[model samples]
Target chain A: MNLSKKSKVFIYILLTAAAIYFLAPFAYMFFSTFKSEAEAIAYPPKFFPSQWHPENFIKAWTSQPFGTYLWNSILVTVLTTAGQVISCSLVAYGFARYEFKGKNILFMILLSTMMIPWDVTMIPQYMEFNLFGWINTLKPLIVPAWFGSAYYIFLMRQFLMGVPKDFEEAARIDGANAFQIYWKIFMPILKPSLILVGVLNMITVWNDYLGPLIFLQDRSKYTLALGLASFKGVHSTQIVPMLCITVVMIIPPIIIFIIAQKYIVEGTSGSIK
Target chain B: MNRKKFFRTATPYFFILPWVIGFLVFTIGPLIFSLIMSFFDWPLTADPKFIGLGNYIEMFTEDDQFRKSLVISLKYAAIFVPLNMIIALFLAMLITQPVRGVKVYRTIFYIPAVISGVAVSIIWGWILNSDYGILNYLLSLLGIEGPRWLVDPAWALMAVILASAFGVGTMMLIFYTDIKNISIDIYEAASLDGASVSKQFFSITLPMITPTILFNLITSIISSFQQVTLVMLLTGGGPLNSTYFYGLYTYNNAFKHHKMGYASANAWVMFIIILLLTALVFRSSSAWVFYETEAKNSGAKKKRKGGKEA
Candidate 1:
């Protein structure tokens, strides 16, 4: 654990350089949002805007119906997170608690399902959703999470497996049924896993482009990701507005990441270990 | 069995019923349906007409874009996988060093991983802009003129890869955790033996985390094949279809071109390719992947066998 001063200084310098490499793009984007179209594309690109333009954010927001996109993003993200937490927990609790027929085989099937690429099922799933008239609505995106994804269920199961059986047994002895035990006893115990799944799901759902792109037809129903993508085609020449919108689009996930970073980092590290 | 016994047996099923139903309807059902659809020209506006293996034939013989996209994707994977792995491992090592304020550096480095796909592509699109980008400016400062990054066909795929390389935080964290799990005694012993840090890394740390490295390798390869959102958003298959990735090709065929049946066939081909590649990686893993527990378990088994023989 002991390090000479020279080595420590060298390490710090390398680390700081890498950090700057990672963060410089965001700082560039942040500054570019304030630049005028000409300044944004000037021959010698300016790192700092000569004039501040705080209203660019508003222009970008109002240029399209970004309010609707923001609303749709929030709606889908929250509902899917809630749905995954509830449904995956119940399924994970069942798998973790019970010794049932075909348990190992079923668990294997679940894990195998995770390996199936979204492309393979994407076409037929689109057809099926069309059959249900769920296309163009948020139903296709939101409804599936209500059933539980294999990864989240696996994570919850792993977390639950580490907890002792004494709590469930005591609850059962107190005349609590299976559902009651799951609700009262296990839900509290599984809160960390739930938060981990929820936050992860929120980031994914918020940022999901392909899902909304395929299913949703109307521009009004577009998620933030889909909406931001549309800017590329329509406003391709307007670099300032595009940069402003890009900045606007990224803030929510960055905020959530900053706030719940511990859970996200620890959750990933825990799963890997 | 009696009613109470039946209830006890079915209770777990009841709890798991939602996932079972979802799996069948959403996952298994679609998988089978897509397989069947791949055989026929299943149109969006018309009834299903079976044309048995016609779609697959067309993909192999008739589709030029499909072949190009496939090659582009393979090239992207070839470059991105090793490059991303090295960067991730290097960053992981940097952050794990005995340095002050390591957490802040880790957070800053990981910020890109949290940013949305669309945002990442857009930011990078601007950064890699031919005339006005910071990257070109930086290069010009060094007396080297930068290529038109996203605009030039020669550099478009590389641009996409460089953009994606920013988001290697997840893989880096995995390596960091595995490195953290390594017992410090090994490193101490290596130091005592006058081994350099680089020597210690290759002989001790690298061998210890081969399993994690394998896991990252397989997942990254599979995901690189599945890459779409960035290409779709940033390049849109780009000038002269240079950055036209396989996933984007399939997406365009299905949604843009409305060749759903053909796209299904394309997807199936990709699925098989992924499976085969995954199998190949796994098959090769036995040679390189080191499991400490497996060694110990086998050692114990050998001792027991020797004792019985004696």
Candidate 2:
């Protein structure tokens, strides 16, 4: 459709205004991280720091056991991503390709599982984890993903269902077993969906706070999100270091998002359609 | 049965065994256990005393916080769900325009959503700080005295709403994808028929995307109710328990107060409310939500000369 010049100008102005609202906070936080604490919170807040203090990142990183928190976060994120990709793919393939008696019911059960809010199940999960002596360890966060989640399984199933019915017939006729076909043939074909699952899982697990907040007691076991939140309690008056840490904490997910924007967009649109 | 036949019969279940095991151990078991715990007066560190319907009765008749938190969550959802959807739909429309540099605008709008809730709360906390915050400082430049955003009970919910709105880009992207999937030929046809842009939107674009709108509506309702992290970190339920959201109330009850039995009752109440709301919305949706297949079948006969296939 064609638009008049005046309306196009109006559109540009509106777009620019929305962009500023979205980007201003990050810009402010990034610039403020380089300032001294006093200037960071001055009455007339400055957009840019008078002097650059690049060492503030170092100070924030060492203010707590952030290094350990970073490591724990990496452990959970990597393991969960790997677990979710593999497990979700297998489950989705079964639902998509197989014909069985209970398949419809089981698949419906999987879909309905997405509606169960975490509040209803978390208390018992806490107790169960405690019973297993898995509390405070990474097991509560990591082990569950190996079993596959409903949303990811649903997404992978959507992708897999789009493949032709006879896509696996040649491999079956060539004497390949089911597991072998899944591993060698389907896995390669499911690469983009796998990356999509891995990326989504990685971002969620990396940023998860409530899990670590509840299960982990010792500071040594804290994830980055938990550590970042601990700053609100311990360093409530210290704004610069908190802002510095917040900036540092957001870097990984932002980088991952930028790199995998294509798959994320495609995967989301695929599921909804 | 022979070994090979048995294996063939069990093959699909084997492929899906991980989820089956997960569903039983992680989901179903916990659900049933939680339900049972609601009936018992379970303490954090001691043996639970079985008291049938006691916790539920106490919640309905006794606890003021239960009612207050429920109202707060409902109030938040009532204001939040519609406001956020409007902004998301508006932004989605904006970014879908055939203008230069809209891609950069799209990325900018979505960047806030990629940041974690923890970081978002912290950033907003500092920015909304009354004395030293930039927002008020900027307001002072305009000779307007900004309200104490996080400290005042009246404004705290609004502050929470403001911070939460930063993440509207996810919903916007969902809407954008659905809108983009719409064929441009329909819009062109409408344009040739002398329909204005706004008319085309209401008649064509809006009706075409009701399915996505319904999807966003349900998901956002669920999320608005489950809002815990932001309220926990940002306001900590505020100066006057003004923003003591039901989710945070439940979290604090179970974790902070260690009233495991009572929190279970609280969780069950919220579960029922959400289920009811979702069912209601679904029941109402048949009247509003239009699918492509339905449009294809009856749209030409009913009305709208152009864009009949949407």
Candidate 3:
């Protein structure tokens, strides 16, 4: 749809306005992080800090041993993302390239699981983990990703299938076996899918309030999401400066998303298409 | 050569080993055991008591809070999914034009979608605070007194829903992409045939994107049913169980109330309900979901007994 010059200008103006609208809260978050308590809540909310409270960031860091929580969150997110990449890529490769026994049936079972809401499975899984002594630890959170999520596997498989089997097929004919085909041929082709699934699941695990909330009973071991919730729960009434911490808590995932934003438009979904 | 052949044969399973183990440990093992737990009166600290169907029976017969939680979740899903999808679709349409810096708009909108659900909940908890929050301050501009959104029984669920609606960025981005990916020839043909912009959209764009719409709808419904953290952090099932989502209710029981068996039973019911709804969607999808490949398979995947071609 070709646009007239006037139309293009109007569209640009509209886009700029929309961008500001979308960016307002984030802008507010960053600037307000340095605002004093009264200044943070000042009517016609102050857009700039009258006095930069660098101490607030330090205060935010120490408000509740969030430093430890940060490490736990990072550890869990990295492990979970790494586990998902390995698990999802493996399963995705199997489903995408192979015509093995129970191939279709197994794939169907996997897809069916995608629709099963965690709400339905939460209590049951909790009970299972409780018996296994997996609670008060990150096992329930980190371990699940090691078992590939159906969605990530589906995405990975779709991407893998699209990677012209010729690469792996040639590798196979070149006296490179299947394991060699996967590692030397397919795994490299699967980088985009890997990054996509990793970032997608990382955002999910990083900001997951529910997983850690359910499993992490130890306060010292809480992930950032759960820690923030506990912070809010503890300081429900006097939550002015906690906003600073909240800003910090939400920034990492958003930054990761922004960095990967350009790649999200890579033509079409994986394995399915 | 034998080693090569052996590795060739074993490669798929080897790749899938971690996944298989994870699936059994995290998903299937827990899945089957939870079903078994639903029958027994088991607490975390005590020995299990076999009370077959007692928990399910109690849910239907005696528990009003359980009933209320179900209703609240239904209402929440009923409203939230449609609202988010509608707004998302609308915004996607608004941005689907060939404009400069439109990518920036797309990125901006997707920011909240990328933000963790937990972070969004907390930030919104501050924004919607009854006492000196942004929402009420805006409301006060019109001389209107806003109720304690998270505290008021009438508004608590709606408050959480409203908070969630802000994250429509991903859906919008998805829809925008789907809409943009509409074959250019189709639009050119439509315009050549005297179809107006709106007509082209309703005819070509809407029909082609039905698959994405259906996908979004099913996922949104499933996501809403699994409501936990936002309500947990924001409302905590609220002033009078107004926002007592079933997911949160079941969690409260299993962890807080220590009724592990009871919670398991509740979860099983929730699972059954979701399974039924998913079955219904799969059933109904034939009539509505306009998968471009559907014409190739006359019966579509759902009708096939063993496995569909999808």
Q: Which candidate is the best by lDDT?
A: 2
- lDDT score at residue B113, model 1, on the 0-100 scale: 92
Chain A TM-score vs. truth, each candidate? 0.98, 0.98, 0.93
lDDT of 1 by residue, A69-125 (tens): 999999999999999999999999999999999999999999889778888898999
Cα shift from native, residue A160, model 2 (Å): 0.6
> Which tens-of-lDDT digit does each residue in B1-310 have in candidate 3?
9996776577778776766786777678778888888899988888999999999999999999999999999999889998999888877877888766677677788888877676677677877778667777877889988889988788888789988887888778778778877789989988889998789878888889888887788888888898887788778778787888999998888889888888889988888888787778878988977877666586554567447444
Descending-DockQ candidate ranking: 2, 1, 3
B290, model 2: CA deviation in Å?
0.4
Q: Which stretches of candidate 2 lie over 4 Å from their true place?
A: B297-310
Model 2 agreement with the true structure over A21-51: per-residue lDDT tens digits: 9888999999999999999988888999999
lDDT of 3 by residue, A140-209 (tens): 8887787788888888877776666565666666787666777777788888878888888888888788
**In model 1 chain B, which range of ten residues has the least summed lDDT?**
B98-107
* Residue B89 lDDT (model 1): 97
- Pairwise DockQ winner, candidates 1 and 2: 2
Off by over 4 Å in 3: A4-21, A42-45, A267-273, B1-9, B142-145, B295-310
Residue pairs in candidate 3 whose N, alpha carbon or C atoms collide under 3 angstroms: A157-A271, A158-A270, A158-A271, A159-A270, A159-A271
Interface RMSD of 1: 1.1
The TM-score of candidate 1 is 0.98
